[model samples]
Target: MWWFLICLAALIGGYFIYGSFIERIFGINEKRATPAYTQQDGVDYVPLPTSKVYLVQLLNIAGVGPIFGPIMGALYGPAALLWIVIGSIFAGAVHDYFSGMLSIRNNGASVPSITGKYLGNSPRHFMNVFAIILLVLVGVVFVSAPAGMLTNLINEQTSLHLGTGAMVVIIFAYYILATIVPVDKIIGRLYPVFGALLIFMSVGLMTAISFSGEHTIMPGFQFGDMFSNLNPHDMPLWPALFITIACGAISGFHATQSPLMARCMENEKNGRFVFYGAMIGEGIIALIWCTISLSFFDSVDGLADAVSHGGPGNVVYTSSFGLLGVFGGILAFLGVVILPITSGDTAFRSSRLILAEYFNLEQKTLKSRLMMAMPLFVIGGILTQVDFGIIWRYFGFANQSTAVIMLWTASAYLIRHQKLHWITSIPALFMTTVCISFILSSQTLGFGLPMQISTILGFIGSVAVLAYVIKVAGKHKNLSHSDKATDNLTRIT
Candidate 1:
């Protein structure tokens, strides 16, 4: 519990200290008009209040991620604590800040466009396709999980005629309507309500933890304990820990969501609060969930047994029900049902924006918006029929893979402008290692190589990629012949 409080404080303090420092590095200029104000498209580039944008962004990046991921991540014991704090401060917040600011600087362009601008055409094209696919996977996963939960919840209550398939169709209909409409219509208004419920649920659980008198549940952290896997499967601590806990720490998908808020931000200064602050807020939520999950079950082994018997959803349900009784059940429903539904809506919306930006299609018109979104939703609907585990597996790897690309792109943008590129470059290289190592070592995919071999190959691959990026950035600088163009890009946008 003391460890949990310390981590929570560290995340808050990191926001004021490290978060502000990153903002300074990015050079937020207040005088310049943001895309929301400058472009002012009624459909897409509408300016929103800072508070609303923050809530929308929070709900966008969060969904069920911070809840489910951290619960599963706690399988590794105290090591999850270290990653949530350090990764959120240095890696996750920074990744989100730069991605959002970069989008704002590029007229609210999608990640592919921004990446293309810095990393050149090939990577941009790749990011365009890759980001869309990732978003689609996210959309499908969120859709299926929540829709199924709702179906069960309803079926259990009364003999509802609705099946999971019918629920999917109903939810996807809402998703389509939300995706094609203006930002402020459905998402902007409803997000603050959803965000409030999420915060309420988190606070309730945290309060329950404080008064539970469950001292025997949460174990003290020790140096030796940090290195050992507490998970039943003995999952390796390096890449598995990092991958299992991507959202609370850092995730590539945040880059995709950043532009959504970027388009709605009324001022460049708001990016810090909306983007970086939201990620920090998510870290706090993840931290709370981690502690609750570890302590609520009486022991890590007990928690692992429950997880094995049910799933992460079981962890959430049993923990919440155990701690808060009827209220906890309500919170459980929100965590399992409402959270994922909200995330699914934004996932599809972000997908629409990605494709629209890729094709330079205007989203103000109904026809254009539908043209960009119809096929994407169709594909997502088709995928909802496939196995959720397969889609989730691919999404986990792909999520970090996209993060590697965004980080390197931000690093290149800094390099071309003669700024401190290592801020992003270092994390980029680190995540590169994580992604590569996870692929090589994961049983679900890649060669089931030993951890030692995977670690070595991951290190080599990451450094090589970093070197290649540096070369490309250097060549781009030489060809462009001036930092003036980079400066102009920001100024004009």
Candidate 2:
């Protein structure tokens, strides 16, 4: 209980501190003139109200990762709680806040654009390519995992014969409706109602599971046991942790949310509320999932059994509605249906933005529309045949690598602008070191990559980008001068 309280405090404090820093470094004055980036008037680039922006940002960033990552992390037992708390604060929150703020300052550009600005054109292209590939990969797994869970849940609870194809259709329909509809008319009304119902369902299910007196099977592995029992084929702990943290860490999805939401900032001051606030909310979601997993299942085998034997759905359903009886179960079903909608809309919108930017197309054109939907449809089709577990792992690794590159870009920006505070740079350096080490170790261990081929390629990609960033940092001589002038004015005032 005390640990939980401590974790909560850390989450809250970290957001406030890091979010403030991001706002300050980016010169995100509410009074600053809006940059003349051609924003589309419709769903793609239409300026949203601040509240809607926050809500959308929250929903987009919060996905299946928070739910599943914590469960898997709990395999390490209570100690994993420490990682969730600390790593989320230092690694995840910081990555998100700065990434969003940087994108905002760069005229709603994506991370790759921001990278191109600070790095070089070639590196930016590479980063963008990596980001898009990762986005597609992660997007598919993201849709599939939840679909799998939803399928299992429906089968366990009701007589509904929801196949993966049917679920995909439902998701696509929801995305179409949400994207084309006015924000005020749909998301604004539906989110609060749905969010409340979800909370109720989660609480009800958890309470029921608690009172059911079903003892959680505690797996017998000690803290040190995992070290000795490390499968020769498995990657080491640090790398696994790094990759696993990608969803919570920095994700390319943030690139989409930041710029789009930045346009609605009633005041630049609101950046904190939107960027960091969303992350803290996500952390709470993750914590809730962790509690659910830790309290319900005592053993790894128990969890595996729940997932393997069609019990994953029962676990979600039973835990969700079993507390309130039949009505609660019905509500749980509705919540499952809604959860994917939030993420699916995000993916659709993000793909649209990436394509619009890639080809320099007007956002509303038929070409942009077809371009956006095509990738999603293609990815969805591929996901139906692939092993999602393996795909998700690869996505996770790719996400972390992209995040590290973004962090490097941000650090370079700060240094060039003479705002390179130790608070930010220290964590940035630490995360970068951890990520690089993890990627190397993953190759060494028989995790993937035929004989370090992938590792070598990733290394080359990273170095080329780093060298470009260094060159850009050196070349941006005027940035330091401008920052100094601003400081001088501040002191005079």
In candidate 2, stretches whose alpha carbon ends up further than 4 angstroms from where it belongs are 25-27, 33-40, 176-189, 192-236, 299-301, 304-315, 322-324, 329-337, 421-427, 433-439, 443-471, 480-493
lDDT of each: 0.84, 0.60
Q: Which ten residues in a row have the lowest lDDT in candidate 2?
A: 484-493
Expressed as tens digits, the lDDT of each residue in 98-155 for candidate 2 is: 7777765655677777777776688688887887776666557656766777676667
Off by over 4 Å in 1: 155-162, 214-217, 220-223, 476-493
TM-score of each: 0.95, 0.81
Screening candidate 2 with a backbone cut-off below 3 angstroms (N, C-alpha, C), the clashing residue pairs are 205-319, 216-298, 217-298, 217-299, 218-298
Q: Candidate 1 has which clashing residue pairs, if any?
A: none
Prediction 2 global C-alpha lDDT: 0.60
lDDT tens digits by residue: candidate 1, 1-493: 6777788999999999988888888888876788887778888788888988988888888866787788889888978978999999989999999999998887788899899988889999899889988999999989988876777566645777677898899989999998988999988898888888788888788887788775443655566665567776777778888887888899998999999889889888888898999999999999998888878776678778888875777787677767787656666566657777887888888888888777777788899989988998889989988997798788888888999999999998887766788889989989999999889988878888888999999999999988888887876654364445434534434
